[model samples]
Target: MSKTSLSLALATALAGIVSMPAAIAGTPSGAFSIFKNCPYTNPSVTTCLYNVVSSGSFVIGNTTLPITSPITLQGGLESVGPSPLYDAVGAPTLASVPAKVPGGLLGIANPAPDWPFPLWVAFWSIVNSVNDVTATIELVDTVQTNFLQALYPPAPDSGEDPVAARLTVRVHLQNPFLGGTCYIGSPQNPIRINLQTATTNPPPPNQPISGEPGNSYYVWVDEANYVGYIQDDDNSLVDNSFAVPGASGCGNVALGLPIITSVLDFLVSGAVNLKVGLPSAAGKNTAIMSGDTSLAASAYVLASEQ
Candidate 1:
């Protein structure tokens, strides 16, 4: 069959399980409580509000208010409760160095606070006011792992290590809003992002071959990963209007890119195949596998409806 004919047949077969729909913005239930001239102090009050938002519940007080969007909170909001906990935005630099080694066995880095996970809820401004809002919450990783591994490879036996690997999660908001972007820090580590391996670099034999010398190994993280979210706590909820040209959500008032959460990983080994998996709350978890070679790797946001 011709390439076009083959492509058409394949698409028809896949249509049973896959559906293509345009992204839709989420609507708020008319149950939010509004206070007039109320001071935003009281940790208990904030905690209550956070619980309502997180639990998908709401209570509106005596006021003539229109529920423009769902009440939402990002990172964490402080409340009146004793010893209130907060969510962390970006990954903080390691006060001390983690374990390091040469080729063969390898250690995957821990997830950064800013690294996008499955359960993260992203918010964007629709009215520019703190009250007017839109939210894009994701409970799963949308990026595919196989695609990422194909694009960037991990370490190789006696080969160079990956310079870096990054994952970015974006939330598209439909309205314009001011002071609507907020980040939360988790009191307990609530998210898990990790990499798993299939084959490790082979260890040297007790006795070296007469002609072959024992190989040495080393791993190095990409400088970009270090600067992107690790070294800099520059987590931001950017306006869609200011997105890079020719990129997603540019010059479109109907859509705004609020949160950009990312993570980077570096590895050193001779192994040809490696797989990485992000923490998930539902569906078949996704994974990326590095076939062979040593180079930078990356995964974009997993696209899904709220």
Candidate 2:
């Protein structure tokens, strides 16, 4: 082939290479999300509890909960509180708290009298930054009871009662800039959500309750981070976000009350060596400042992994 023809062929190959699709970017460090299957299980009653606990870590920006370098398990279920609807029934009427369940296990049980009413567990984590997130969830039925036991001694039970239930996991990426404001707009609010019901064990006719065994659900967010931004000028604003004063600064801030608010003034100005923005800053920060800030507890569940 002539030199001119060879040059033309090379140019064509270069053009094709340039037109190739660009590679997807990786999730930044310190940003992560959760994962699980729908219709979770009661850790105390299910044998597959290990599956939920063993799934994986929460990934934030570039730092992942349960870090790898030092093998630190930094993040886990802080506190699985009752769903908002259940909270209205009063704390005493709610299901038993999963105090016994370890941080690793994402399951819990409802004590007696409650009859295991459907509940929602809140989970939170703080990485270095924020990013878009995705999650995985799984559900499995593990136990069943005799629905007719109330009528007769043995109830002359028949086949297993069908266990039908769905799992709904909602993920909220709190923005520290908006004073821990939750990512709320329309559909982008929840980072991950899975709704599912048990497909097996069809309910018996005229039966008020299905005597099917309990089921376990697992949901996880493999990738997560912050993409939106707020216009503000406050370096103390965490993560380059806003630095809300008091508890109303960010909508998603999850700092519990009483302790933090009690000593706000003292910690911030008194002889204490308080530094704003730091995790410990909670104790010293004032909970009375202005701007848009919601109590941390109202925003995300930021507590010990128990």
Candidate 3:
């Protein structure tokens, strides 16, 4: 089985242990609950979308993090065609959801041989409390015009897909040892993921990978809404050309202690970056987001709330 599959299969086992909270919670009542986060209130917002990334893998440097938990992206678009070039939502649209990375630090499960002995002592001391490490992908910023590409992707040139979405994001590495502020990238220097629906054209070392637009369909929330049908369905976004920055602020909390906090921070950050290949260059990393998407008129979504 794939790492994602295996992680899912073994998720129950981790349940007995302390695990991170599930992603995308609190479903509101109504058929359009899936699009609950849609910005229907914005008069300029005409299109709303809801996407659930089911299974995929994110490789940063040397560490391979499988997406066992689903990550959701939802919001609305002011214009379909980039003519006007409206944003998805005035506020951040991408949900800050955590996808647990199996095997904790160094991809090693707890209670391993010589647990907390020798070199494993510092490693286990930090992550032991969290049970497992969780990586949360949070959006830092994005181009408003890129939203249209997800719906009407441009044709591929040669064999490579055109850029679909330009997303600037940071990965939050959460564990008791790393503390609450540990992160791979920050808002000022974020990882930019330029996604496409067709075959990718990576830099070097990495090979080209393909993605699908998936099937498209329409849905009518209510016949009385008198709005155009929602154009939405499944799609896959792939990118292997983005770079990943080194982690920072790890083990810099009160938990890391006072005098040795700086040392712990330096040790934890250095170990993680070295082991995971921090500051990975473009073409050395990969991200595949496979999920279903729905697009509905803001009026239709607003009407559904009634």
- List pairs with backbone clashes in candidate 3: none
Q: Per-residue alpha-carbon lDDT of model 3 for 1-306, expressed as tens digits?
A: 232432332233223212222333333226566666776667776656667788888888877888877776677666444423234444446654677776675462232343224335545565554567788888777544443455555656654337766778899988765678888999998999987777777999999998777766444333343333344456788999999998877764554344355655576677678767788999899999888766555554555453
* Cα RMSD for candidates in order: 27.1, 26.3, 12.3
lDDT by residue (1-306, candidate 1, tens digit) is 232432333233223213323323232111111111111232322221121111111011111112233322211213211222233123211111111111111111122345333212221122122323232322122211221121223335536332121122222222221122211111122212222222222122211111101111112222222200001011111011111111022112123323332211111000101111222122222222111211110110001112
Q: lDDT per residue, candidate 2, 159-211, as tens digits?
A: 53221111222212223211222211113221121111112111222112112
lDDT of each: 0.19, 0.19, 0.64
* TM-score of model 1 vs. true structure: 0.15
Off by over 4 Å in 1: 1-185, 199-306
lDDT value, residue 284 of candidate 3 = 97
Worst 10 residues of 2 by lDDT: 287-296
**TM per prediction:** 0.15, 0.17, 0.76
Query: For residue 129, what is the lDDT in candidate 2?
Result: 42
Q: What's model 3's TM-score? A: 0.76
Count of clashes, each model: 32, 72, 0
Best by TM-score: 3
Q: Which residue ranges in model 3 land beyond 4 Å of their true spot?
A: 1-30, 83-92, 108-122, 126-131, 143-148, 158-161, 222-228, 256-262
